[model samples]
Target chain A: MPSPRYTRDIPARYRLDAARCSACGHVALPRRTICSGCRSQDMEPVRLTRRGTVVTSTVIHVPPDEFTTEAPYAMAIIETPEGARLMAQVVDCQAEEVVPGMELSLEFRRIRREGHGGILCYGHKGVPVRRHEA
Target chain B: MRDVAIVGAGMTRFGELWDASLRDLFVEAALAGLGSAGADRVDSIYVGNMAAGQFVGQEHLGPLMADHLGMHGVPAVRIESACASGGAALRMGFLDIASGQSDLVLVAGVEKMTDGADVTNVLATASDQETEVYHGITFPGLYAMIARLRMERGTTTEEDLHWIAVKNHRHGAMNPKAQFRREISVDDVARSTMVAEPLRMLHCSPVSDGAAAVLLAPLDQARRYTDRPVRIAGSGMATSTIALADRPDPADLDVVRLSAERAYAMAGMSPERVQLAEVHDCFTVAEVCCLEALHLANGSEASQAARTGYSALGGRVPVNTSGGLKSKGHPVGATGVAQVIELFDQLRGEAGERQVPDAHVGLAQNMGGSGASSVVHILERV
Candidate 1:
């Protein structure tokens, strides 16, 4: 997997962000150019939390190419504390061990290699939050 | 805008067509529609396709299709909205006809995905590839999360999801053009290899290659071509955040609801009046979400409907009577238009054994990526 790296400065990354309405208290992802809820242009950027819980998950046995090597890997939609949700891989755990409501923390991991090391795309991956030993 | 009607419909047998190229699939379906309509000419053409550049390493579908279909120099445009491309194309066709700018128009959708290419990488183009696919979130994994959340909400069960697959497969067995013509039991879905945790192989639609086409004309002129013209009563479309995590309600699809509302308002009908529908069942849970979004049933009632056979043939409201994406196949661009074809047959009472009795009003809801985009159309038998 390509290592997880934030491409916020890059134009091609399609970074995940939200638009907070100044009037109607509405929030939207992708940092809308104008708030659809209140039609307010006074929106601001809010970086999503790096932690969340598994709302649901799936394992693809017959996987896709960038994901073929990780066939049967666990993937889930993690709802962050900021109320934003994104589909991501749930690693560092068995496929069966993952379940809804399991707390997860975002981590960097290799997703894929592009064009014989031309570009290495990286992003967030989730891992079950291991409880600290007493 | 003036009303539009589907003057004709056509599609190729959906499955793995190893012998056919993208152009072949497209030309075949377009020609079939032209032949069905008996129209010697078209004012404009619209083609719905998701990823021709990725699937077949080709793009610029408009000119290519127009040339191959022997309609070169005609105004041709391609619409892309992920899986809802076909529905979007149909809407564009509707606008062209409704505006009185065109008398006869052709709208076709085609996708050739069986070239044995790396589909995973290709499909990843649909989502936030960097944020989502980077961690290995396949399409199945994305939907599995929805299923798991639905389960946690006590709105549905694994068995309910299984029933959807089983029913669709049963219906697919009767569809001559279906990719998977064999029926599968609920056990098959439960026991099948897990693609995404709760979602199994059978619970998902196959990567298919096919084409579907339809001829659209003004409602007043529709009768000149075919006595069985299906009048398009209403059309609605909505778009949401491209990323699923951005949606406020993971279980709710406001886009479908909003689109349905707009369509129902235009059609002068309500969900309660729809007798049958062809919904985007790209995944089992998608059907459930569609049912809710359409307000055909309350939230989560889709699973109950599936389990009790209410969504099957001869049920409360037949859904996916054409086998849905699960059984019929999801050739991306072709799926939405194919759903309309099924409704066209049903409205004309020509759906054979799968026909819903006294089916006068029908609806087709086609969606793209994680409920981010949707188009709904209401069709009535004239």
Candidate 2:
């Protein structure tokens, strides 16, 4: 990935910043000028919640070049209470343990290194929400 | 617009063709198509190639392929829509003839995937780089998520999925041009190494290097080229969200449904009228989804089509009779053109062993990037 492209997505990756369309209330992550739902340009910047529920997931055993070291990791589509969805890696648990309906909190973490001498890329990863023991 | 017909079709045997360069594959397929049509030259050419720049470090394919095929000075262009590039190019050729702009047009799709480039990374470029690919999601990973959702919804089962590979491999055994030309049982598919959960290595289409080409002409002039010409009845293309997660229902594949609806509407036919089809089965789950989306089967019937032999040869609506992307080979851009070749062969009674009896109408559905884009074409034996 190019450095400029990575830098442009920092706000969404780091803070879950999204844009909500005033016309149809559709929230677009990483923001967009035009609305996908209603094609309206009336949009407002909003911060998405850090927590979401897993909509679907897959454990990637054969990964791409950048994520080879993180093989056997779970990546999932997480839906937030705001009705927005984003894809993120589900970490801090076994890959097989991440399932649909599981609750997770997105946390800022180092995603991967572009190459041997490339800069470190950081993004949000899903951490399983644990319950308090009585 | 005037009606268009495919007067000729040809393709290179799909596999790891380390001996063939990108230009060699295109020229070979182009010559075969021209020879089959008995035409000394074409008025224009359209090349369907996904990533020649990334795979072979070459671009400007329009002129490059035209010059190599000895058709320089003719109008030539390349069309791309990820994996659906072939179908998109065919559509362009169809329009060119239908609009009276060209009399004879050649459409070819080629990909040299064995060229030492990182195939996975090159393919990943089709997806949303910042959103999806940045997270390390391979194409298998995307389809695996869809498979999981389908399994959870009872739309398909692991066993049902394996039946697809089994059926395609069985059909591929009869196709001399297929890459994997041997039969396999459901057990064989189940025992294969798992690439992504619910999708084994057998369930995925292999990365391949090959090319396919077709010659198109106005329906009125088609007889001058061939005695038996397959009429291109309808062509439709549609798109959806690039990122799979953006869809309301990832398994629905609305792009396929929309494109098929347009094609069926234009053809003045319904899904039932399609006697045979070559659907994009990049993954086993994809075939299941495409069946339902194309309206060839509904609900669980899509999953059960293979198990009950309904989708196999000699069934109600034989599908993937030329193997499929699963067993035949998916050289990205070449897949759509290859699908047309299969339909053309079957319609003309040229497909020796896996021919669909009395096949009059056929459909080809090609999709790209986890169903983000789709192209549907309906053909009739004219």
Candidate 3:
């Protein structure tokens, strides 16, 4: 990964930082200057909760080049409690077991190595919330 | 605004052509289109290409292609909208003629995807790189997520999705330009390797190398180029959120619906008047969603169209008569231009075996990544 690109997103990747639209109360993950809902520029920075719910998921058998070793992993669109949706890989559970409406706790992790000996990219991964914890 | 017409349409055989370079494909298709229109020169050229730098380590395609085609010194530009690049280029050409800026225009779309680049990674660039690709989500994985949502909603089944592949392959068998001409049964789709869960290999459009081109002129002067010209009655394009997760409803392709609506309104007709169609069926589920969004099928009709043979040739409303992206080959950028070529052939009564009976009106819908961008056009036989 390029250092500039990797370092620029550290706040969001490390802390789940997001921007809330002051006009519409819509939250944008990874932060944005403009709100998609109401097109407001009056945005406030906010950190989203580490927990979210799986809206949809797929078990990828044929992975991309950067993730060849991570084949058969579960990737999904997870909706945070603030209603901001973002994509993440669901781990620490069977790939096939990840389903919609399942509760998940996002954890900071190393997503992938950009290339052989390249910079290691970091992001959030979802772990299923156990029934006992509920 | 003046109306535009497609005076000529041509394309290369869509498949892995190891012999053809990117420039070779573009020039060949452009010359073919020119020949079909009985002309050798165009006032301007629009090249639609995605990821030329990534695929072939080349850029500045507009001047490069114009010079290669022996039409140097003419105004030329490249347009990119991911997979909808071709359609977007066509739209530009149409507007050029409609707005009376240029008399004759050439629109071409080409992609050489089998050039040893990381095809999966190259395609993933169409999605939100920071939010989606960084998490290792492939295009199939994104669509598979939608397929899961549709299945969970009881709107479609795995069998229903497989039937889309079967129907397209059957149609493709009749198209000599198609990559996969052999028809397969639902069992074949079921047995194919799963790229993403619930989406098999057969369900995904293959990475291909091909090019397609079309000649556009004002409708009044169309007869001078060709006696049987297909009028571009309507052209529409719309865009939405780049990431699939950003959609309010993951299962609904609102971009398709919005673009189709704009095209239908411009054409002064409804979906009911369309006798044939070529939609962006990059994935099987995409076709299902498109059918409903285009209003060709309503409610459950979209899911059942393949199983009931309603979307097959000789049926009520035949779709993808040119085999579509599924079997016809999806070279990404070339797909949208090829769809218009299919409509041109069908409207001009040039489509051989897969021709729709008395097909007077046709529609083509091309899309970018995960419904972020969509371009729709309606053609009428004149």
Q: Give the top-scoring candidate (DockQ).
A: 3
lDDT of 2 by residue, B265-325 (tens): 9899988899999999999999999999999999888998998999999888888999999
lDDT of 1 by residue, B5-45 (tens): 99888899999989899999998888888888888779999
Residue-level error in angstroms, candidate 1, position B168: 0.9
Q: Which 10 consecutive residues of model 1 chain B have the lowest summed lDDT? A: B129-138
TM-score for candidate 1 (chain B): 0.98
Quick one: ranking by lDDT, best first? 3, 2, 1
In Å, residue A105's CA in model 3 sits off its true spot by: 0.8
lDDT of 3 at B280: 96
CAPRI class of candidate 1:
medium
Q: What is the lDDT of residue A113 in candidate 1?
A: 67
Q: Per-residue alpha-carbon lDDT of model 2 for A8-103, expressed as tens digits?
A: 888988888999999999999879999888899999999999999999999998899788788889999999888889989999999999988999
iRMSD per prediction, in order: 2.5, 0.7, 0.6
State each model's CA lDDT, in order.
Answer: 0.84, 0.93, 0.94
Chain A alone, TM-score per model:
0.75, 0.94, 0.96
Candidate 3, residue B214: the lDDT equals 99
